[model samples]
Target chain A: MNFSRVIYNKFLSSWMRISITVIILIPFAIGIALLLKSLPIIRSDSIFNLVGSGKWAPSEGKFGFRPYILSSVYVTLFSFLFAAPVSFLSAIYLTQFARGRLIKLVYPVIDILAGIPSVIYGVWGVLVIVPFISGFVAPVFNTSSSGFTILAGGIVLAVMCIPYMLNMLLEVLKTVPTGLKEATLSLGATNWETTKHVVLRNCFSGVVSSFGLGITKAFGETLAVMMVVGNTVHISFNPLQSGYPLPALIANNYGEMLSIPLYDSALMFAALLLMTIILVINLFFRFLMYRAVNQ
Target chain B: MRKRKNIEEKFFKSLSGLTTYSLIGILLFIIAVVFYKGFNALSFEMIFKPPEGGYYYGGEGGVLNAIAGSVYIAFGATLIAVFIGIPAALFINIYLNRMKKVQNLFRYLLDALWGIPSIVYGAFGFTLMLFMGLNASLLAGIITVSILITPIVVRTFDDVLCNIPKGLIEASFALGSTKTETAFKILIKQGFSGFITALLLSFGRGIGDAASVLFTAGYTDLIPRNLDEPAATLPLAIFFQLSSPIPVVRERAYAAATVLTIIILSISLVARYISGRNTFSNIK
Candidate 1:
């Protein structure tokens, strides 16, 4: 009877501990979910009403985020267009062709770049890339000021996202089994042929996911874009045109919101939109990764 | 025909090699450009003195206050996070071992938090603090940064704790030790190095972060004598000085950037060392 009692007590204690942990973690998790949900509802009246109104007046309590969202998508898409191909090519070369001390030297540089903070990138964008764009790209694109244009911002953002995509591609390439590459090569295929046929084919899903992550990161970035993108609320097809991103809009305006439910709600709604975009991208990447791994 | 194939193979191989070198070259160019711009603006006095006429006054003005504020806030946040995050991670690992679905959910939430952009975190911090009526204070900044870093620490520490050989725990239990005692003494001791590594990584991240602090800790030139007062940090000082219209302020910003970069690089190196040492010792 005593043995049975001891066994029962142990089981009860273990179950109690598990329950306590669940109790603590569940509330914190739910709070985050709740915050995400509240974002869209906050912006329904003023911001959403102004969505097709084409007017953004902060003083008059009128603001529309459609231009900001459009700018974000345009700049992020342009950045991905530039960063994706270069990063993909680089990954292919590094994983397939690089050898010995050269590989050692190259990989660490990429790692350090991956770890560098985004704020530093902001400074670099302001001081270096802004001038270069104003001097060269602005003239070609017929923009007056190059400092805060989408071209300058997109270029800097592309530079920032390159390392992210490259790193992801490298990992996926590394995971490609050695035998597959050797099998292709043994059939009289050249190194380029083997890489193009075997390695690239195998890592296609990873490359797609990496590209998605890059686009998401570019879309979500605020500081670098804020520094160079000129934060105007106008929409334009030209890359040299000035614009604001969703995150920049939230960061710049949220403090001055003056207890206005409309403004606050708009900010929250933009945040909700951004979070949803990020969540969708992350889920898509995870699905691709799982498929790749399983195959 | 065989000779031609060999020649073609050699050409493609060299092209691939060139591509790798160029990729690395781009990274080097970025570092080089930053140094080139920053080096011209660096002066010995900038490190020791404050800005005069919107420029660094070498003899008297120093980044001492900013450095002090950064260390204080970072330490404060790390202390709070360690207290909460470490135990929460342990709870997840030991107690919820049977709940795979819940564990997976927590892992996904943490990853989402990690991936959410820093600006969002800054906005969140701004809202949460203003709502709580703290305004822009050091305590507010610390609280925000602590929340920002907690997920990272929890994830790393949880991984370390969970990877500990299970037999050690079984042995302790077999000797009639309570689960709590076994966890606190044996499992924790075994994972001490990894725990320290996680702490240091979080500390480095908190110290390096500027966006989250920008709104939470409004910039004040005066030395922060209390936690209730707003203070400047290295990153914030660099940012404001760079953006300031004054030429002197611009130079000071560059100097500050150089210093900030060095500090971040050193901390990252130390973190790498700690992680490397822990993995090596674990292997042994």
Candidate 2:
């Protein structure tokens, strides 16, 4: 009885210590996020007015994040639109049709691609991708100097994101039980039918979550986009024009300003926005994962 | 009739085989392209000289300084991250197990932090450093990268710790070990391999990261004399040099890139080998 009591006391003390540690660490971790969110720039009286202003000059205390925000969204969306279908179809092919040595080979290649450094991707985009896009795809798209255009950036972004999406989708497809596939096949379903009805239907939530995660990743990407994004703060719907992203804007302008409160606050404000977007997407993914696992 | 069915089956199998092989062929093409373009600019002298003023040719540079900066900054950040992240993870695993709501909240925050783009962290570092009056120091870069990598380390360590069987804890307690003692002696000791993997993974990531370091660490030609000074790294060197119009600088950029790639690849290979060996030993 005494020994059991001692053990119980030890457990209780450990629990308390853990709680104290967590309480200390939680605020330290979230301080960055909170500072980003609560800074004065987002709440400034001229916030709405600044959105319409094309000027980003720090000398006069003018700060406009609209162009960078818009470009980030536009390029991210374009990249997603290109990457999603290709990756989804590739996942379909791998999960459904791949066999033996081929599956093994493809898996390692995808892993390596996922692990490749972003800077390397940036180098490749600048060296090989830009030249190729200029020489080949630019004329087809009717763009001059493909060095810094949305389409060129989007293509590079697509290549970077494909492995991530493919891996997630493949993991999701693996969860569909063998019995479901057999049952569909026995009911006179073709291979395609079995895949669509049995596999994809069962993993719809997983697929959606994967897509959400991929889009979020693409949104936060910096190095490759910075290399090819033309460094101009302009808003345009055209994929053939150069523009800036939030990350690029932050990287480009942060060091140049010495003591402009508005400029520093604006960068913090953008960081806050980026964090919020990431948080929302991750929450959605977690919710979907929970539901998928629970069901 | 059976022989005829066999022939038809063989034909379909061969057709499917061809399509599968073609898919792998496309992946290999991408790798080949990386090697082809990257190799064209490689030379021994370029890797040994400092950068000239011109695009490719003017710099009298080797990448020695940048490589040293990367290793210094990465190792410094990894040490700080491991110190903070491991404890935080341990605390989460031990205390939050019963508090599902709080645990979930912490988990969500961590996931968001992990998902945040490194550039945003770079921006955060830039703002913070400016506020602190440290203008583009290597210390600022290290802190930013440390913050960026913390979530990954915490999550990985937490996962590994949580996977440790409850029975071990119970047994340790039964033997009169204190909670802290058991945690330090048994649980962490057993999970050391996984913790090492997380450390190495974050180290590699920090070494390869360019975007966050770009604004916070700003490029400096000379080697850092102190933590307050600006520093160059392999990734930033590659970024600046590769974009230059100078042929020699571009070639040097390729050499730097090749070195960076090899460093990252070697770390990853070590991670793989360690994990593989662990699994093999476990099976025995």
TM-score to true structure, per model? 0.84, 0.85
Summarize candidate 2's per-residue lDDT along B1-284 as a digit string, tens digits.
65665565455445545544544665565556656755776666456554545434654547767887888789888987887777667666655657867776776667667777887777667666766789787899898888878777888667678778878878987998766566667767878877887898889988999887988887776678789988888898888887788776676677678778778778877876665555332100
True contacts kept of each: 0.22, 0.32
**Residue-level error in angstroms, candidate 1, position B176:** 6.0
Which runs in model 2 stand beyond 4 Å of their true positions? A1-40, A43-46, A51-60, A259-261, B1-31, B40-57, B98-104, B130-135, B161-176, B279-284
> lDDT, candidate 1, residue B237?
78
TM-score (chain B) for candidate 2 is 0.84
Question: Across residues A174-209, which tens digit of lDDT does each residue of candidate 1 receive?
Answer: 778889888988998887778878887887897788
| TM-score for chain B of each model, two decimals | 0.84, 0.84
Taking every candidate in turn, the Cα RMSD to the unseen true structure, in Å, is 4.8, 5.0
Q: Cα lDDT for residue A222, model 2? A: 84
